[model samples]
Target: MKTETGTPILWTAADAAAATNGRLPARLPAESSRAEWQATGVSIDSRTVQPGDLFVALRGPNFDGHAFVADALAKGAVAALVSAVPAGLPADAPLLLVEDTLAGLEDLGRVARLNFRGKVIAVTGSVGKTGTKEALKQCLEALGPTYATAGSFNNHWGVPLSLARLPADHAFGIFELGMNHAGEIAALTRMVKPDVAIITTVEAVHLEFFANVEGIADAKAEIFEGMTTAGTAVLNRDNPHFGRLLAAARTQGLGQVWSFGRHDQADARLLDCSLHATSSLVTADIRGERVTYTLSLPGQHHVMNSLGVLLCVKAAGGDVAVAARQFSQIQPIKGRGLRKRVPLTKGSLTLIDESYNASPVAMAAAAAVLGKADPGAGGRRIAVLGDMRELGVQSPSLHAGLAEPLRLAGTDLVYCCGPNMKHLFDRLPAALRGRWTESSAELAPLVAAAVRAGDVVMVKGSAGSRMSLVVEALLALDQSSRAGSAVAALSGS
Candidate 1:
């Protein structure tokens, strides 16, 4: 495993000061020289600061990061970026003094992009943004040193942080852009200025803020704001909003637009797919060449997203055949579709952890993947679901709408939680309803108790729904069972 000690020095005091337009303390410690100070990495959290990290003290409404500047410095940080010095720190400490730490971080990101000479790609969508971004990263890594947004850090602060951390010599950079309201992507994209922009697909996500799906599509289209007529735009041809997105890209003066989907006219077209419980075999035509590969991730959603990844690789001048071959190495990210087997007293059961987040479209797609799995002998397919938040007035109907998909998935039993998911529970047939509760805390134990050997279980919901609690409870069963076995052996001895 790679450790912080192995990381190369990423920033120097002189370069950082020039990038952020920040100033060093008037008088540094006698032993400390500006040219001698270096940071191996950048961090925002004091708790996770490494020995040579440059920590940025960001202030928020509920918490002031200035209070942790001393703590970060004590934890081996080379220096801290601060709007104002903390009470305990000396005026001559190794610090980057800026007007505002957040803006300073953004400035560092802007300058980093300006100095970078590599090909950059930005991805945005209601769903599949992170998955597609990760896929692109995996493919691009085979060709050169690649930098990508960590996890799902694609927000206002996350994008800038990812950019600021971009190494000066990387060959490629992939970024994920997300939004809950209008114009968010526009600001982030202008900072990115990607050479290739991709919209995996737009759906009824973040409807709580938008008037409808069209508005969401328009918000996603803001990713084009940073690109000029020379750059390429990648769209999902199978999506209903494809025409809208295509028009928007044209309006933004993008000179080239490439599309990926199962549609006949798609530039990167999926010709066929053999979906399995944990992986799939896909054959697609990129431009005019036929390419086939195996994807380790389950679900048709991922297969479709893979097409977009190829288009990005081609647009960025990467070897299409090499990128296509890297698909087999890509695995499912945690809480998205990560699958594990839990050992019970007599046997084991499969657990698909999709608890990180949820949406109507994502929920339906997950159900489709579950339907493809072949449960063990006497095992049944089960679902434990919580609410899909941020749906506005359609929350009730959207929750209830999941009943059809779950039923079609051949789910034998279900555990439901949250008020919105109660709609789905009530809509389910009596024989299919295992339990229902007002919260995941209340539902976790019930589902954990009811699950048995020979069961294929899936737990999923929005982050706010805290469905991960239920997943934790289910996993804890294995630990308790092992403890009991140990106790029995000790008694016998």
Candidate 2:
């Protein structure tokens, strides 16, 4: 039997050498202790380095992490994983020298997977990968010890970093694999070789890299490349690309596949869903077994994805009942869909933070959530939106496409920012239009000053748009005196 602990082991020099096929460079700092060379976990950024962590200095085309090796050490890093020693470091610095730091990180990840005696699950899709990955982590953790990718760490570097940090003793490991171009997921999935792979859904995200949605679907199907021979592929049967994704998975020799959705053909079928303003209660039939669970997350997309989460749990031979019960503990990830109230003077305002990445599909989902929000007696539903990037030549059309969804949501007012969103701003009716600006930086102050009591403000944008600034500015309003604030609630229509 394996033992799991929240505290990591001292990843000793010998252990790292064996895992990564690297060795400590000669140069013993006189003040360094033996433990200084042993890492408890692996980190890439100097600013986020934890005391006992091995700071992996990954070099990119723009910036070099090697430049921060000393800063990482000063932040209490146990060792620095570097391809080349930097200037001014002690002769005996806790350095695990490698031929290539990236390759070394991959090697360590491979070793971690080799030593892991637990079920490994991989999640991929156009959207909701992080949310689904998080749901699984929460579910599996309730059943037993589990590890999952942190935040949206689902890229080439993030995958290896998360895997290399996997504890030897755990019941489950969940990884989120994301890619824009083809062949990316193939390489990552092969490294993970998950026992179960899930494609949450296929959408028009990352259209900048592919010629069409089919091309994006094909690229997403690459996650099947890493499935074990006996692995199960959990798919979204309701998605338009479900047939294409299912065919791709079957071609890869994944015979056991479970289709999850509200459709009749779905193995994990939705029986019923009681939707709420802030949460949902869903009853699902998992391959003939019926179970009901309360998901604290809002949006129909999340409810649909929870079926996939339960499917993954059942596929991993876990107790579905136990896992389903854990759904209540699932909280909205910050900037993803977290709900909070900013204390105002007379009354508080509801804040829905969706200021993370966005796409056409994601924007619709966010709008749907905003629609269902039960604003206060005098409150109004407001959307603070920034540009959604990476649509290539279709950026303007896609941006303009959001107008109908906003109308359907009965948004009392709309605040638009960024050049791409101007197309949508022009299409809005004068009654619903609040303001429009070329940039979120300029729009943030105006939106912040406009928010008032009984208002539910939902902010969203692409990663490059920096709409979080608008979210920050609105949150800052909560800090001001609630009484007689500049923001006044819109008069009842």
List lDDT for all candidates, in order.
Answer: 0.91, 0.89
lDDT of 1 by residue, 328-404 (tens): 99888889888889988768789999999999999999898888887888888999999998999999999999999
Clashes of each: 0, 6
- For 289-371, candidate 2 gives per-residue lDDT tens digits of 99999999988999999999999999999999999999999999888999989877768789999998899999999999999
Global local distance difference test of model 2: 0.89
Off by over 4 Å in 2: 1-6, 26-36, 482-493
Pairs that clash in candidate 1: none
Model 2 pairs whose backbones collide: 27-91, 27-92, 28-92, 29-92, 345-482, 379-454
Model 1: weakest 10-residue lDDT segment is 1-10
Global Cα RMSD, each model: 2.1, 3.9
Instruction: Assess the local accuracy of residue 227 in candidate 1 as a C-alpha lDDT between 0 and 100.
Output: 96
The TM-score that candidate 2 achieves is 0.94
